[model samples]
Target: MASTAITTLSGGLVSVQASLQSRSKTLGLNLSCSKSVSAIRGLKVASNVQIDSSFLGKASNSSLWASVVSKPEEKQVFSSQLQPQASFKVAVLGAAGGIGQPLGLLIKMSPLVSALHLYDIANVKGVAADLSHCNTPSQVLDFTGPSELANCLKGADVVVIPAGVPRKPGMTRDDLFNINAGIVKTLVEAVADNCPDAFIHIISNPVNSTIPIAAELLKQKGVYNPKKLFGVTTLDVVRANTFIAQKKELKLIDVDVPVIGGHAGITILPLLSKTRPMVTFSNEEVKELTVRIQNAGTEVVEAKAGAGSATLSMAYAAARFVESSLRALDGDRDVYECSFVQSELTELPFFASRVKLGQKGIEAFVSADLEGLSEYESKALEALKPELKASIEKGVAFVHKTAATAAST
Candidate 1:
């Protein structure tokens, strides 16, 4: 027989109790509800619920609840264990843009986020208002225009910049540089001035160029921390993993391919020889997969016939990276992801590789992944260096030219 009771407590609180009697053993649960009965439609169980020891004693022999009942003195309640103690404030720049809107929605659903700030040049308030109705834990705030940018970034723990023009049919990422470069430079300057210590994820394209532009801008502001600045090449990695999974018929969750170098055409290198679970590939298979991965962005753009770029997948990848970063910030011990950052892994000043993330930022780079490359991968790696180097130098030059022009004026 089972019995349940509901009692109203002081201060608009409600108490729910349930007891079950089976085989002469009684199991009881006491839940302290924070909401009133009227608000119980989507009520979450309070963390301070009490559990009778008889239930633990009866379930001690069951392997399913062993971990829950093993530690009685530690007071490891299930609800409390699931609650995140350390939540962070994340700010999304260009929240009204194609990538920013979906990215903001995904991030708003994270249990680890306490505040979500959405900033854009226009139409951001409506976006924020829409996302606020999601019934998530994070409070959504909107900041419109340059004047409100600093407030959006203030006290933010992570700043994600996806605020730039999208790629159209027949437009190379470099074609976006002139417009997106200035956008990234302006947004990054606001980041440097407001949340200098925050982890900055640059998702603006030509990431190969915009990352360098961001680094230079931060350097000028005297707040550049190589570890905290990242060029989000997660999209490339996501595309690689997904493509490889489809080719091999492996589960998508079981596949992981490390993408390196820059974020543009040939600069995007998918290390097929280094895929996890150690699958063998024919030379033709390797070539086909590598080229497809590198050109995945163009495939999406062309598929849409200039409608838009890879906004949904880009948002997904960015959200995954953001979650990994938040986990690292929340003291998760073994958090690692592929990101483009200031690195000594290769001759290039900045490269994308697997790096271990931590409380402050990048704790260590998995530089060993670069060793013992396949012959084809080695040749391709060498082939990408010059073009990537040229892009890097171009970005550096843009910043310097801009500075010099301002000084001459």
Candidate 2:
């Protein structure tokens, strides 16, 4: 039987609290499990560890109970009931930003994250302080500015970067390239120095450029793991699903669209031909839907005016991808999602398609046959490469230029 969490404590529930070892593991204490809790693994507590009876107050609220003892270290399962509780460390760069704030909340709600590290240039400490109050199993920590960046990424299993400016009205993704490019470069460099093998999810704008920038930086550090780097195009897929559901008048959850290629204007390709439940569309409908999916980001930018971009929806989409990644880390071999990564699906070095996720990250890139593509998809795929190629080159050039500048200085 799969490990299961204890969810059915009726009336006033009592938290079975026990002290656990600290981060240093210097102190040793023991606690015996009840006969009913025979599946409890290695029940040890330090002498300094103490149970806070306050946890009993939260019986009505649905939050995982964590030992308040010790700085957040590796997870220790107190019993088999907490089986699916997440024990991995996830660090989010730009955790104080628009998308990061909500994204942090979603991850906090997960039973999978044991520790959550929030890092940003500013405003992050407060965000961490705010999120810490939520009674989740995951412990939250904040690191502000570049000085603390390495500390934030130190032991992360997954590092998510949403650290960049948002798109403005009338601005193409390339328009934000120069600014976001430098940001991604700097952040990925820190990631390289610290958690080189962490599953990297790049959500910076101009992802076509930033993802390549990340790939190259990791290569420069000699720690490039192709299976680990990902450009989150989940928003494109999310939009495709929503729009397709509306167009076909079907239930939203029933819709599934695989968005591929680089994550930008023309490059965002929704494989409408491969939508699940086998939906049908006319040529005209397909054309219109395709265009809408491609331009969905702009729609949000325009709608938000100048205040901000699609923070909430982008947060939702990003959270979806992060959850899938955490699941993959937890040894769920069946977890698969569409993302941009180093690939050979086309002449380009990177492409987005459905990829099977597991302990080793991307186990396989599963793209549908392009030879059997519909006429529109083939044309769209051909036309997208030029802009995408330019973006990729720009990213590669930025890294080389930065390295040269450093060498010169």
Candidate 3:
């Protein structure tokens, strides 16, 4: 009778245990096996087989305990074997203006950026909110008014300044420079204070003078990194590629033209000799392409009928440069882009040329294109140095005078 009572309780317990094992642990069992027969017989002769709450508690604890102890070590080993992907934080000053909106959109699409900060005197909140909805990983933050400028630059990996006045139909970059220079200087001063280590990509014109102004201001702050400072002259190159392709009746997508020297007319030198795919151009074609490329901004300004100049293309070019800088920050090697920088390739303190970018920024200046120049290009290049030299000196003087004035007051 005792054995019969044991059999009934033991059979119930065995069923319960098997159900729990199959449901919770996914363990397969053969109920028809010889071991099952042995377990049934062994249980029938046992004294008691009561189902207890404590037993359930113990099983739960064992499963959780096993996972907690083993998973962490496994995860650590797995993570140690993996590599980290690149990331970057980019800030665009003047981001609510005409150029800023489209530029912000393009940057919002870049996989390289982890954060994008937009700053302007007005209308930046909408830009930020709109860009934030995009499916990219970059977090968008907007700063409006001059009071938030420093906050916008805080911890930035790259600061692109496209702030200041745009040119009218007859205005030279020098004419636009007077107003834009002040804007660039003030913003760069904030940059030098807030994120001294960030790469400063100056898109404010006149780039020739404004870049020198930034260099001098950072120097005064005693935190200047030449490799981290760049004057984004990418629009010149973009115009060169487009104009040459348009004139030569070639496809624009595949043509790559290198434009060196300063950003202004006569200063911009398109190295047509080194054009990709080795296309030949008639002298008439060369002159037409060069003039068109040099005067592209003027053509846009005139086409706009004096309201604005080159905002869309300028924004695109600036975004391209920001991407290049971000890619460099992400630890990309051999990332080459043309930028005007404090260079020794020419007599001018700042020269635009191709530079390889890395973590240190501007890993090396690629002077291969500068090795030879056509007679037309060489003479144009020589003429530009004097004008570019004056522009550089003027910027240095502006920073010095501004600093001295601030000191005296």
**TM-score winner among the candidates?**
1
Better of 1 and 2 by lDDT: 1
Top candidate when judged by lDDT against the true structure: 1
Tens digits of per-residue lDDT, candidate 2, 310-391, equal: 8888887887787777767765555668888998988898888888888878998775535577888989999998888888
Q: Which stretches of candidate 2 lie over 4 Å from their true place?
A: 1-86, 169-175, 369-371
Q: For candidate 1, write residues 1-409 as lDDT tens digits.
A: 1112212222222222211112111111222221222222122334333333333333211001111122334433232222335779999999999999999987876667889999999999899999998755689999999999999999999999999998665667567888899999899999999999999999998888888999999999999999999999888888887898899997655567888998889998999988975899999999999999998887988898878889999998888788778767876666778898999989899888989889999999987778889999999999999999999989999999999999999
Compose the digit string of candidate 3's lDDT tens values, residues 1-409. Answer: 0111112221221122121111111111212211221122112212122222222232210001000011212222111111114557889999888888888887776555678999998889998998898755578999998899888999999888888887765677667878898999889889999999999988888888999999998998999999999998888877876777776786555566778888888788788877864788777777777888888888998898878889999887887677667656755553667889999999888999888878888889888888777777788788888988888899999888888999999
Q: In candidate 1, which residue ranges exceed 4 Å CA deviation? A: 1-83, 169-175
| Cα lDDT over the full model 3 | 0.71
TM-score each candidate. 0.81, 0.80, 0.77
- The predicted structure with the larger TM-score, 2 or 3, is 2
Candidate 1: worst 10 consecutive residues by lDDT? 60-69
CA deviation > 4 Å runs, candidate 3: 1-84, 169-175
| lDDT of residue 359 for candidate 3 | 83
